[model samples]
Target chain A: MNSYYEASARERLRLLLDPGTFHEFLPPSERVASPHLLQLDTPAAFDDGIIVGKGLLDGRAVLAAAQEGGFMGGAVGEVHGAKLVGLLERARDERPAAVLLLVESGGVRLHEANAGLIGVSEIMRAVLALRSAGVPVIVLDGGQFGCFGGMGIVARLCDAIVMSEEGRLGLSGPEVIETTCGVEEFDSRDRALVWRTVGGKHRYLLGEADALVADDAAAFRQAAIDLLDTKPDLSLEALTAEHERLGGRLERFGACRDALDIWSALGIAAPEKLPLLEADAFRAAVAGKRA
Target chain B: MEKLIYEFDGGAPVKATQGPAIVGVVGSGNLEVLVEPENLGGRCVVEILTAARGFGDIWKAVLEDFFARHKLADLRISINDVGATPAVVSLRLDQAVESFLGGAS
Candidate 1:
């Protein structure tokens, strides 16, 4: 697949596993239909929008799932979302060592009415349930489509998130934000601001990102390995502390304009220079410097 | 053309697979696909129920090629397309494997 995310997924597996070790289930063969799209006279994909599976890492069991950006920008439909929630619940029951997700989504599919939204929430519930059950979920964000809407919340729920410069995490897209919050608040046309606001670079700097790596699939694998090895099991106090810190962070953005303002607030003298830096350099520059 | 079902193998039978599971945007340039495990026999049923019906042959050819390339089994696939590319279709197939079989390389 020439698309960056497809390459990323394939590369992620190659770097994470030995050759010929990975297996694909329910592939395109399972003619899973979208209950919503049929009403709109749309074509339905076999797996809907999300893919869930089980794989192994170092002989340890790991539950896996990836978003199909190729299919409707990997949007969530009823069947697709149900499948995700079901598999996640299964993972919780089975208690895999970990669950790894490669997210490339645009959030809920409105065509399916509330079903899609419910599915997203179900997935979130499953994630939180897994967390509550002492299992870990690691979210990987590095697709061109990015994760948006309900998915943004899902990204936040994970135990840890590893992102790429290509990854984006936000509740709303720039255009939607512009439509709702007006262009003054968010210029939908500005790519730089979008990146600065919710892009992986900014998230990494803000401590929302546990790790930031290149788009290289192998790099993602190495990073995932490094992350799985040292998973942070935060206590409720730590979680609260992080939440308090995050609340303050979001408030600071309330009165801010350019993303540079955010960087400046984070104590970077040349905030403008950070965007041009690689993921590692930017990560190093902002290490322990977030508000 | 068979109804087969299976759960996740819980591992990657092969190395890394690539691509998107859904295509086309909710809008014009957007689309979504779900990539997960159907874990059936090697024969995957690619069911395409699209508003674009004449594309049945196109759908068949695509699935045939995808099944041949990936060798997915016990898998059932459903696609909701607003018009994606061959590029997108292939990616979604890869993603289905990735999502279905968590964390395969």
Candidate 2:
């Protein structure tokens, strides 16, 4: 297709897997749409804005799901969230080569607040269960909407995350931050500042995202293929190492006001120029400095 | 919060359909319709749970119009609505029927 980052959920699924290997479950035609949005006079999509299915990634059996960012900001509602839980649960049972989640959500749909929240928690539980079962869950956050709220935490809990420079990952959105903490604290209109705070590059530097790849379908597919063969042990030793790593981050830059300060603190010679560099160049610059 | 239940008669049984099918989302100004095959003896049953109250008459009129247009029968249509307009409700009903008939799949 065009660019993976700009493609729709179905297109992303097609591009990520080998051609003609994608088989959708509860596809839009099935009309398993949400029953809640209609009561409130809101338009709804046929597939509840999520496409879940089984596909082949480089000839390996894989289960994949992608969110539709254009539909309700890719918010996770009851059916959308349930589809993810079902997919992950199936992965745990089937032990697919990997479970790929093309996450582009803004967390729970506020309309169905309670149900959405419960669904997200269920997804987190399913992700943990799949991980414990030795099934890898790979998350790809490359959509313009990014991944935020409970979805951000879900992405972090995954085995691996592949993000693009154009993508963002965080708990709260920029607008929410600005609304909660005055403009002086966080100017939501400042695009650069917002991206610097939670963009892919920043998350990669913080060791939150595993791989930073080009915003292309081929690039993302290649990155996933490269990582599918290696399964990182989530043993106590690994958990301890990860705990220390995150603890060190908090100790070092938890008090830092600006993202540039964190970059400079990490020995990135020029923090301002970091965002302008290409993915490869950016990786090289922060290769040794990344925690 | 409004709870409305409307049962309509004089409709043919839904054909070429099996099992349950759902469509739409319960977002602001939106709603969802779930169509499940039931032995209602040629009657179409509709249950509406909405956040907007005092619209039972409007819901009745809209649902009556939908039932008149489709040959839906022996089905249970459960709706969870926020404040969807008549047009959206009609559309979701049609979508639910289409899906019930194995059109989308």
Candidate 3:
């Protein structure tokens, strides 16, 4: 299987979209690199570590963006965040069939600290605005960097999310949590514990992610195509319902420390076995128990 | 960060019919190469912005080896490097050239 987790941003976009249909905006030839990195004596990427463009997904016009995880942990710098915001703003105007964000970021670049934070905020607003404009925003998270920090919040703000078992999503990353809360609270080096806590499987079971896919590109493609029609309801009633749902989730699972505990509380038999199951089997096992 | 420029005489100008091609990523121990077609009077110019300071001699050696192998000309090669070894740099240069020549995508 061609793992989506292992593919670069460009490779993932190429594999996810129709062949020869991706037209990049501000490509490397444009030489639109970050000026902050150079002043800080840091290396800068040509495309600013994010590739945003228009592409055809199942022959449907769509705006897409992918973050290069190998570059500075896919941090959102000024240019990187601007590229995505520009895409979403364009989507708002063009009203494409869908907008796909293959997010693989640890979020805000420390080099451009304030600019990166402002960029993330702008991206959040743009995504929400696009959704309010009736454009379906879909997030595909399966890369090794996963999504953390501000990017994690951006992913959740989308209309729908498709994640692979290898992918993880959370506000604060494992290392951050360990650093701020102590290793006794969250061990960053314990890969298994980290995955179990924030992995795609857990997110899907928690209803945080709409679809749970395998790590292969084909699986992500199929899942993205399937979710192209999902338009989130941003109405007052919908917002109230969402608020209630989240409050209920906190009330029910706030005390749960680990995902296994949450799974057990959801009444799934042999909760430990849930992690061992493949995507298909895991979905089947938690079909009725998902929150 | 250090900016280095090297220009070399070449056998023939490269016929980059397919616009411009880029490869590699600016990551730890890796670099990105952007090869653009230009009219340089049968000369190849390589410009690099590298994070590893005080490696001008090593970079010169690597680019010399690359120009020797490819003999490319009339091309503007730009590289963003982050402490990549000579082997990886050479490999990315060849990959960039191959992509520029439409041999690989």
Candidate 4:
């Protein structure tokens, strides 16, 4: 398991940014601690496992946050949540051209109890607020900590999403799904099947990902930059048309047992090939031909 | 192996008769309780399920501890846990119950 941050930060944005352009705010020096972990007999990191700040890429005013997978699996707690809220609220006030959240979370921090839930809810509010302010909120799920639980909903709500072959996005974790639906519905032990069902490729084909890119940050940044140009706004006519289309899609999947069934319905030709291809090749291969 | 169900009235007929009004997340190391209004003959019923077994007396002691401190009723609260301390759990349960019972709308 390579450091996702290292692999991503290096390949993705390390070269994309001009020298000295990315400025980190509320750095470890600020010592923002997780108010919840103190009681859990655990040590809290300086940024509560998230790296947040303001940075410039091609002179684009970007505010961002990334999970520090090294610390407690990069879970969100009260302070972590508040800091993100504060950052997004500040971004809204400033009306940045774009906001990218490098989400690498296990969703709400259960250790913190209700505080983490409130934190997630507050972040959701801030994301919606950003959209209402007409700022593009972009989410990149490029690796292992794949967004889950409430963050899955958050990603779905984002104006745009960029994913990698390694990226995963879903409301319930495989374990939860298996628990709720039994092995027949899903087998959490089957890693490849899990990836095939919820991996970025599957999501991209589903029209959930605006663009898919390589695991490296450079590729993801380029993809992210490309997607920033598109916005999601619904017209009444379009909404009705969409409902009609989705009605057809839903009907296509009546009583469908697995994502593979949906995949096959979409005519992937070879759904099994999804998880193996590199992010770029896969996206190129499946461009259009899907919703 | 023992059980205790605590009750209180936050000084009035508060919360819904039934239907959930949830707030909070249950992430690793934390838990949140959702309190909703339900008319089971008009009294708040608290049901708790926790992974930390063998603490029934302590659980009762804490809820008893909380109910004795506040006035709350007309709501049913269910708590889901992933290993949180008593203090955080209590605070959230109180807040959820308070929110459900209706306050500053």
Candidate 5:
């Protein structure tokens, strides 16, 4: 009954991991808070708003991390960013069974601009390194904060992604789009439009997300456990297929404005009803149509 | 570029067991403290880098109180402060000390 979108970083980790098996690294008690935030007179959390640790998922060893969105929009500062890098590096060394990232971030912290940017790049490199080592990095983006900016790119680079219908995944945020392209192009206040453009359902249909699950923590955790059984092929052939898929998206939806066009093109009857359908019903409808 | 450096002497010698310990963050109204074991001739050295200038007396008072209460010795404490209150500074120092003494991993 617990919603993943509303859960705290610790709560989400507990729900994802097996019962009472999570071991934290550099926990809040270690007080590895950001040194950059102090110079800017901003309140900082002891763990730098990101919890990196290890746990068991269905009795399998897994490395996991979660972002605290309530703390400064879950922006990545120096220590926060370093923790992510360190986790991935550890994953490379330890070679865990899997790596799960419960991402809810707006990307870099503006307070530590340069350092945050560099940190994100370092994390991206680490992720690639882990992926190259055949370690599956899965992302579950179901939090209310969603994932945007550089984190979006990072999510895309991951092996697989499981997101809720309410979860959004995009490189640029709605506000940024509205400000840069004008309200006529993108009205940030239009919730429906925003969701249509970046929500989990849309990303799934676009082939950006691997799976779309319900908003509950149990649903997400189940989906993650299921994914662990199947290792995705990261070969060049798969990469080429993904490239074609992305290219096809641009060619198909290049001039499309209304999301209805997309739904209709995908052969969904009565595209208007798709948004209001429940998660299970929607999945069924999409499956039937695809079949 | 307003930086303040002060060193205090005549404090009870610390056990100096750990390498270094850090606590807190540098954010708005926050700061980070780094404590390292050093042989400073029984003196506790303090270095502060702060954007909020013209508070030397307040900084001195806060650090003095912390040093007096803890009686720490042979330690080099560096602070990167924004505008954190005396209470926060004190708490960070305590946290650093506890962490340095193998309190938490």
Candidate 6:
């Protein structure tokens, strides 16, 4: 309740949903752990680090999935990916009011290698399918691991994304960038630089995330409830508008070195004060400044 | 990785409400325990697949202490460990049993 950022994946879903409404599918007793982990001599979690099931969100039927970031960085393995795909595919038939995806993964599991990559691709397609079918797929990003890699792309494909200030959404994580591009390119140890670049505030300002809330489960729950009726437009005109909006953002701020520069370009007065502001105040101040 | 199994003569069968009660997460220096009611005939079985090898004796001592504290019967306790300390293992075991008896939380 205090912090969704620190709660376990199961704890997050339990707190986010109506009390005692959650019913897990392929529970740990099913022993559906990754076979690749076993082959690689790695410890395998019983549920493959993902908890997927049906639950009532404010008395409406919903399918949800929570990724255990503590286990293997919540990386998508064969089984984990399959579970998500199965849930999304189920939504096509169940036609739940909405599908909540509590994302906390750091992309594909390296232990599973190619299988992990293929699994993420399958999940991406499934998310698109669900969205095309008019099912509201919402992402709650408040986990410590921060959604990145393939999972970040999957988050973008969803109908809506709600994030907490403690949450981060990006393609390549700081460590990954520092490893691939030299330390000079990105100092992963600089926590301030990391947050300013990919933190929830930055994503929200860039119009990458739909809403920003506090790092508490109740805030996320409220935000999800508010957006339950939202159905993203998938028509050709809407897609073209989105494409043009992204292109215009790139053309306007592509040369900016930091978030502050982008914020300044958006005519935000005193952009440095953004992080210090509280969630509600921040939302008010950045009303029309977002990309 | 090492696989260890321990079975003990227990007291009464667990009166859990539904399916298995799972606790903990398989992170570095952490582990997950799955407690499921089974027809073990007054026995509790623990199966561990640990990333840290050569700690079988330590695991046995810890699990022994756990079974002594909670004399749960007809339970299938499975653990997937990633070099978790004995204290963490005991904590997860206790949490698992507590959830098993009180229903999944």
* Model 4 Cα lDDT, one tens digit per residue, A1-291: 233335532223334444456656675435566755656644555457666677675667777777654455556788888888898898878876677788877787788858888888999998887776778888888756688877888887788888876788888888888999999878989988887778887788878887777766667767766765555454578569868877876787666777777877777777666667776667666666565
- What is each candidate's DockQ, to 2 decimals? 0.20, 0.07, 0.93, 0.02, 0.10, 0.93
TM-scores of all predicted structures:
0.74, 0.75, 0.97, 0.68, 0.74, 0.97
- Model 2, residue B20: displacement in angstroms? 19
* TM-score, structure 4 vs. true: 0.68
**Model 2: CA > 4 A from native:** B1-105
Which model, 2 or 4, shows the larger lDDT?
2
Q: Residues A1-291, candidate 5, lDDT per residue (tens digit)?
A: 889998878789988889878888997546687777766665566688898999999999999999977677778888988999999999999988889999998888899978888999999999998988888999999987789878888898898999999999988889988999999988989999888889988888777777888889999999999888656577899889878877887898778788778878889888788788878888888874431
The candidate, 3 or 5, that scores higher on DockQ is: 3
Candidate closer to the true structure by DockQ (higher is better), 1 or 3: 3
Error of 5 at B5 (Å): 22
What stretches of model 3 exceed 4 Å from their correct place?
B103-105
lDDT tens digits, residues A166-241, model 1?
A: 7899998888889999999889788888888888888887788888887666666667766665444557887899
lDDT of 4 by residue, B11-105 (tens): 34653343444433444556546565565555567765454667766676778777766555666666545556778777877776665555310
lDDT of 5: 0.83
Would candidate 1 be rated incorrect, acceptable, medium or high by CAPRI criteria? incorrect
Off by over 4 Å in 4: A1-16, A232-246, B1-105
Candidate 2 residue lDDT tens string, A1-291: 368776867678878899878888896547677779766655556688898999899999999999988678899999999999999999978999999999999999988888899999999999988898898999999998899999999998888999999899999999998899989988989999988999999999988888999889888999999879757467999899999998999999999998999999998999999999999999998998987
- In the predicted model 3, the residue pairs found to clash are none
For candidate 5, the TM-score is 0.74
Native contacts present in candidate 1, fraction: 0.37
Candidate 4 falls in which docking quality class?
incorrect
